[model samples]
Target: MIEGPYFVLVVLGALWCGVAAGVFVAFSTLVMRGLGALPAARGIAAMNSINVAAMTPAFMVVFMGAALLCAVIAVVTFVLWPEPGTVELLVGCVLYLAGSFGVTVVANIPRNDALAKLAGDEDSERSAAYWRRYLSEWTLWNHVRGGAALAASAAFVLSLT
Candidate 1:
C-alpha cells in the first residue's frame, strides 16, 4: 500500500496527468477540427498563436511538473523494488514520460516549429500544403499523447489501491 510522501506524490502526479490529458484531448477533439475548418492562412495563424500561448508559465509548470514527478516516482520505484504498487507506479511514469511528454518533444514540437516559420499567406501553395499535413499529423500525435496521459493517470490511481 502506498503511504506517506510517496502516496502524496502519486496523487499529485495523477492530478497533473489528468490535467495534461484534458488539454491534449481538447486539441485532439474540438480545437484542431475548428482550426482546420478555417482558411489555410487563418488556421496557420491560429495554431501559431496557440503554440506561443501554450508556452506560458502556468501551462509549463503543470506539464513539466508532472514530468518531474514521473521521473522521481520512477527512480524511487526502482530503488524500492518489490514494494507494493511498484509495477503500477512504473507503468504510470513510463506512459506519461514517454508517451505524452516524449511524443510532444519528439513529434509535435518539431511540427509546430515548422509551422511557425511559415508566412501564412492564404495564396501561398507552400503554406496550404504544410497546413494540410500539419492538421492531420499534429492531431494524430495529439490523440496519442492525450490517451497516454489519461492512461498514466489511471495507473497512478491504481497504485493507491
Candidate 2:
C-alpha cells in the first residue's frame, strides 16, 4: 500500500488537475466565446487583463502546486518502479507535466506575452490581427490543456484503484 502522505499528495494533485481542466473548459466553452463577442479592442484588453490577473497566489497554489506535487509523485514512482500503481501514477504525471503544463508554457504563454506587449488598441491593424490570432490559437491550445488535464485526472484516479 502507498504511504499516507504520498497518497494524499496524489489525490490532492488530481483534484488540482481537475480544477485546472475546469478553468480551461470554462474558457473553451464560455469565456472565449464571450470575449470573441466583444469588440476586438475590448476583447483583447479583457483577455490581457485576465491573463495578468490570473497570476494570483491562489491560482499559483493550484496550478504550480499541482504540477509540483505531480512531478514529485512521478519522481518517487520512478525510483520505486515495479510498485502496483506506478504506471498509472507515471501516466498522470506525464500528462500533467508535459501535455497540460508544458503546453501552457510552450504555446499559450508566449501568445499571452505577445498580446501583453501590444497597446491593445483594437483600431490599430496590428493589434487587431494579433487579437484575432490570439483568440483562435489560445482557444485551440486551451482545448488541448483541458483534455490533457482530464486524462491526467483519470490516470490519477486509476492509480487509486
Best of the candidates, lDDT: 1
Candidate 2 lDDT over 1-161, as tens digits, reads: 55688788788878989998888898889999999998888988888889989999998887888799888999888887888888999999999899889999999999998888885455688888888888899999999999999899989888888
lDDT of each: 0.93, 0.88
lDDT of 2 at 137: 93
- Runs in model 1 with CA error above 4 Å? 120-122
Candidate 2, residue 12: the lDDT equals 84
Root-mean-square deviation per candidate: 1.1, 1.3
Query: In model 2, where do residues sit more than 4 Å from their true spots?
Result: none
- What is the C-alpha lDDT profile of model 1 across 1-161, one tens digit per residue? 67899888899999999999998998789999999999999999999999999989999997899899999999988988889999999999999999999999999999999999895465588999999999999999999999999999999999889
Pairs that clash in candidate 2: none
lDDT value for model 2 = 0.88
Q: What TM-score, over all chains together, does every model reach? A: 0.96, 0.94
* Candidate 2 structure, TM-score to reference: 0.94
